[model samples]
Target: MFGGPYPWSLYCGQWSILPPAPKGNYLKDKVVVITGATSGVGLEASKQFADASPEQLIFAVRSVEAGEKLLGQIRKAHPNLQDKVMYLDLTDLQNIKDFSEAIKVFGRVDILINNAGINPNFDEGPYKSTKDGYERVFQTNVLSPFLTTLLLLPLLRKSSDPKVIFTGSDVHHIAPSDLIETALQNGQSIISAYNDEGKYHNPTRYYESKLLLQILSRNLIKTLPDITTINVNPGLAMTNLGRDFNLSLSPSGIVGILWFVANARSASKAARNLTSAAA
Candidate 1:
């Protein structure tokens, strides 16, 4: 749905949504850590994993309050699930490092889902850089995940069936070569290109980040043979990823919504795919 071809059934509206994750203790006693678990596909996937009975479900989030609220909701529904919150702001490299180090206390990490990301929308002005001096989209979507996955490798190795999951997009296929070449040649900085208002589109930057993520996942599997690394596109879903779009206030936004509804899957349906990948 995100700029790639898919079976017509996904866009047809008549196809039956996949049922909720199968009932079982598939993740029983396993330690699961998910970034961006406070909302959207991440939140839904957390619920599904909770139902599967993971021993520990830790959410590494930017907002502790939001994470606590989500944890409360999940606990209310599934009181027996063990879910906790840890602070992680991908915009800050130190926060990522601290979070990864804290994970060591858990002893083992059976599943790691790098599901957090951002799409600033077409209207958001000038490029923003992270505290680490990297472009915001590039750091949040690609570099942070790369670093987090690497830092957690030792913990992941402690588990019998360790798996790392990366949330990717079909939009990756459309990443412009000019941008890729520029970033590569200029030493990992896409800010110059992103700041060029005349040539930059928010979607393009987002797509490029996803493309980089897929590249990271592919290369990781070659070296880390003990852990299974998987990249998955959860299809286009109605989520807060488009919070910046302000669709209700503009004509183009309305058209965008209509197009999304026709082609996108719901967050719950997308979560099914994510949880299945983890299982």
Candidate 2:
């Protein structure tokens, strides 16, 4: 059941028995950077890394205020956590470039975790595009992360054993291909295809984006053999991911809640996968 055309071996097996987080101060001299560290899996991964005692931990978040608040909470427990929170809005390509340049102050990045993502509810309205003229979800989940990794490659290469990690998902296996086929048939670029409001499908957008991300991660492995690139499937987790869905106490919201209850694990537990991959 775990291994087939849709191989769940690596995904399901790992979820069933998550790798143990490092126990010692192994990251003493390493500079680790994580995006979306103020919430959900990102927040928990930040905490886990903090406990491990990294030389430097940077949180690339959308809000500096929220990042700092999270840092304060972490400091309360560790009392000596060396961390900084910087603003990084994945919705804007320019903002991602600016954030990457700002990271130069840290010199080198040993671990870069592109953990931030979004799943907008298509049920609410038609597809919306970012200022960069890409679909909001596509830009946030795929393009921005790809750009961040590209910009940070030079710094990551400077490290002895630099690693780049993407928080992928299992749903990618079930993502539809008809959208892509239709895009190709119409001779539209991948970006333009996804940006097309007529072609927008809520159930498939996130899955397709993640599938694309995993594909990119694999290419990184081949092209950048020196850097250890991995796409980690964190499994379903109960986080603020659905905050955009605006799930109130309505009938649909009740169904959404039930879906989470049956399928999603706690964010803290799910975050172990991220930390393990980073370690």
Each model's lDDT comes to 0.82, 0.84
Residue lDDT tens for model 1, 1-279: 232344453444325566567678899989999999988999899888888889999999999999999988888888888778999999999888888888899999999999999987745457677777777888899989999998998999999999999999766776766876867787875556654556656656787788889888999999899999999878778789988654563675666667777767779888887899987
TM-score of 2: 0.90
Residue-level lDDT of model 2, residues 97-212, one tens digit each, is 89889999999999999999998753545678889889898999999999999999999988999999999988777777776787789887877777888888875687789888
TM-score of each: 0.87, 0.90
lDDT of 2 at 132: 88
lDDT agreement of model 2 with the native: 0.84
Question: What 10-residue stretch in candidate 2 is worst by lDDT?
Answer: 1-10
**Residue 71 lDDT (model 1):** 89
Evaluated against the true structure, the overall lDDT of model 1 is: 0.82
> Among these predicted structures, which one has the highest TM-score?
2
User: Which lDDT value does model 1 have at 146?
Assistant: 92
- Stretches of model 2 off by over 4 angstroms after superposition: 1-15, 122-124, 182-188, 246-256
